[model samples]
Target: MENSHASPGLLKQANSSALHRALREKGAATRAQLAAATGVSVTTVRALLEEMLRDGEVERTGLGASSGGRRAAQYSLRRDKYYGAAVCITDGQAHGLLVDVHGEIVRAVPLKAGADGLRTPVLAFLDGLFAQRDIRSIGLGLPGVVREGCFWHADKEGGLHSVAVEPALSRRYGVPVVLENDVNAAAIGFARCYETEFPGEDPAETNMAYLHFDRGCVSAGFVAGGRVIRGCGHFAGELGLVPTADGRLLDECLNDPQDGREYTARVLEAAVWVCGILNPRYIALGGPALRRECIGPVNDGLSALLPGPMCPELLYTADIWGDYQIGMAWLTAEKIFHMVQIIKK
Candidate 1:
């Protein structure tokens, strides 16, 4: 929980995260802008930024654009000095990535996961990927529901609980890890990308839903106020369990591939279902089944379903389709950094 009166240490960590987020937005920020963006006082921002500067967390850039008065000093993170490792472990494939502080993909490598539909190989494979990277922090995106900082999945033992996947894996590498739902990670990426596309102060535009459709489907994350909507136990976007007569959920779609017509019908049905309930601005589609060719008919049908209300534009790029593993790796890196910050205190 975040408190207005946080402990000194928590306050510093929170401010650091705030500073990082602000810097990421335009790759540079002035003290006043950072203060206004984070709701932190200018004095506090200077103190915290100075502390970060001393620790090599932020670097001073040239002067900002001239306002009415003297130009303020600008600052940006030293992306090269810091690296983040991420693992996006979907139901089908696993991907690892090394990202700079800017959240841009630097190194993207794919990994084969669960060839026999088992957990041991996937687990071992993930460990090896991290070993090769020798990263300081890790972020992991899983295919299942994550609750109370814990995630539940299928293992040798059926229905195994795994929240501290990073910690468990960290036991081997001795680093911090943050295991998150893949949908949540995708949502984060979508939110960031969208925010980059459309700059804003109001939170409504940032508040939207992202759905990743594959064999067994998943909705990664939802954002309001430019922050992930993490429900208690972090199960905010687990739309899989939404009650339905046909049992059509994210995971169910991913695991069961059908004929093109059947797949199109089922997905259109899903679009109608989501439209009735969510009515989001735009729907982001990912996973294996959401290819450019695959979504056209469904798009036409869904467009026909609604006239005045703009049918949410669909986004199905290769990055969302084939590069999920890399996205996962980026996610893991984010988690690891967060965990390190928490534990170092």
Candidate 2:
């Protein structure tokens, strides 16, 4: 039988890309190991590595252990060659961070969103950033709906909605800007966590969801087949609008004393609806709700609300203090650097 982890010529360009991706994750890898991992010919792998090294993308790692032969020079990726700036805005507060390729925050600044200074502060901030440190691109996540680089939202009707925000920020920053719903950005971070953990696996093999309950509003993102589908206008996973018996959402139903009961019921009903449509493998919940000590109430609520076939166990990781702050920064950086612009290539 043919070796599954093997390939023919496999196009010079494809081999180069595969080698770069592997280098990004493994830090250092030998030519033989790279060939085994990438299913490309050893000659092709060496050529790709040489190309990247010449382009300042990869570098030699001094030297490594010798095995009955001349000590071969080890090699690794040169991640320091690039860095990104990420900004996340929620309610009326905007925070910025400098993120490296490894997703570490090198610098961070918080700016209060204002009626007049929102644009100027950010513009000055970006200009000053060039003076302080190096940044290759910019990534931003907005609290509300985004269109043409601006924030806007509405109910079923167009009367109650937010205005747009992308153009102003894009102009201020100059670097390539990508605007995504804050909730969706959080979800992107969560999905990225899974991706990093299971590098070699096809992430599309499993489904994961993240529910973030922020101060004013609650939102969620659903991941299926390894990608976050942000529907038209970059708004896809809005858990707040899940239907209800009296035409109200779970969030909106929290009016009277007994609203939690109805809200729980509606959420459960919605879960079944989701299960019917997607049949997810795992459903993980994050955000503020998980802060509650005993999320048994949430699990019980979801269990009671969903049907047998649709009821997936609820798992919570309320460790958002670190995850949220870093996730926001990483999402912003990843969105700017590793997102469509880089990935599609």
Candidate 3:
């Protein structure tokens, strides 16, 4: 039998993808550097780079420093080769972002909508974005359980349940769609940001978590090995359903707190639960409803309950939606890159 593992075409595409990923992460690289980074031979890297340069997927960005003799030519992704659309629904508004291959926002717009049902408003937002620029792929951060291109379940008041969000959007727009839980998207955004800030540290090796409270519900997301840990039912982050110590539901205590102290205690309970399980390097408290002041108390409470080594760094961010957009942009961009064809002429 012939070697049926991968055709020559498929192997070439895989090598091209590896080069694309290396250039995307490194910003720019010489042929030799790309070969070393992607584990492709220098001769193959040179040929692929030539094809990418001809196709306008990459551009020459001058030359690299000389190791001994002549300097090698450096190439980088053509940031404007394609655009991706990203949206996050929260606070009675739909936020849309037009991003480049590097996941940098080119434009941003907001539209007001019903918090309970955001499908229509989100579509309107994307319509506006498409009018401004062509979009190759879309990523959505929704407040519910999503599975296999469908919004399977949502909170009691949420109106997106039972909606085939991914297929509908993809069919209408003629692009790939990625639907992720709002908290999971935020968790990914945080981890990617940490990886960018601390170079040489792989996010896939780093464990992180994000806990959010908003819209009368609490959700948490865990990112182990750079991937979201969605449970068997895609309900892993539904922290609201957990039972509280006072014989009440966790969300019930959190939503109907009698005072600030009570609210802090409730949030602490959830945070401690996360610590005991994942023991992430960082725990970010976010969402429109999360108070900035609660971060300190939550951090202190976590330290008090857990020993020094088990405690993770606690922080709060007012820009959860921004993080959501970043996560969505990167997700959509990945699909777009995979679909981009590099024809060798």
Q: What would the TM-scores of all predictions be?
A: 0.72, 0.74, 0.89
lDDT of each: 0.65, 0.63, 0.81
Ranking by lDDT: 3, 1, 2
Residue 213 lDDT, candidate 3, scale 0-100:
82
Q: For residues 1-345, what per-residue lDDT tens digits would candidate 1 score against the true structure?
A: 233446677778777777676676568989999999887789999998898899887899999999789999998887766666766666666666676776677776666645465256545654665566545666667777776546777677666656555446668666666667777777666655665577763434465567665544445466655566777766666555554446655457545756787667666666666666666666676665564565888888888987657477766645663344444544543543441123332
Candidate 2 segments whose C-alpha is farther than 4 A from its true place: 1-18, 35-41, 62-74, 114-117, 147-150, 154-174, 194-202, 259-263, 286-294, 301-310, 319-345
Off by over 4 Å in 3: 1-4, 114-121, 124-134, 154-161, 339-345
| Candidate 1 ranges with C-alpha deviation above 4 Å | 1-17, 112-136, 155-164, 170-175, 199-204, 207-209, 216-263, 290-294, 321-345
Clashes of 1: 33
- Candidate 1: Cα lDDT at 145: 71
Q: Which residue pairs of candidate 3 clash?
A: none
TM-score of 1: 0.72
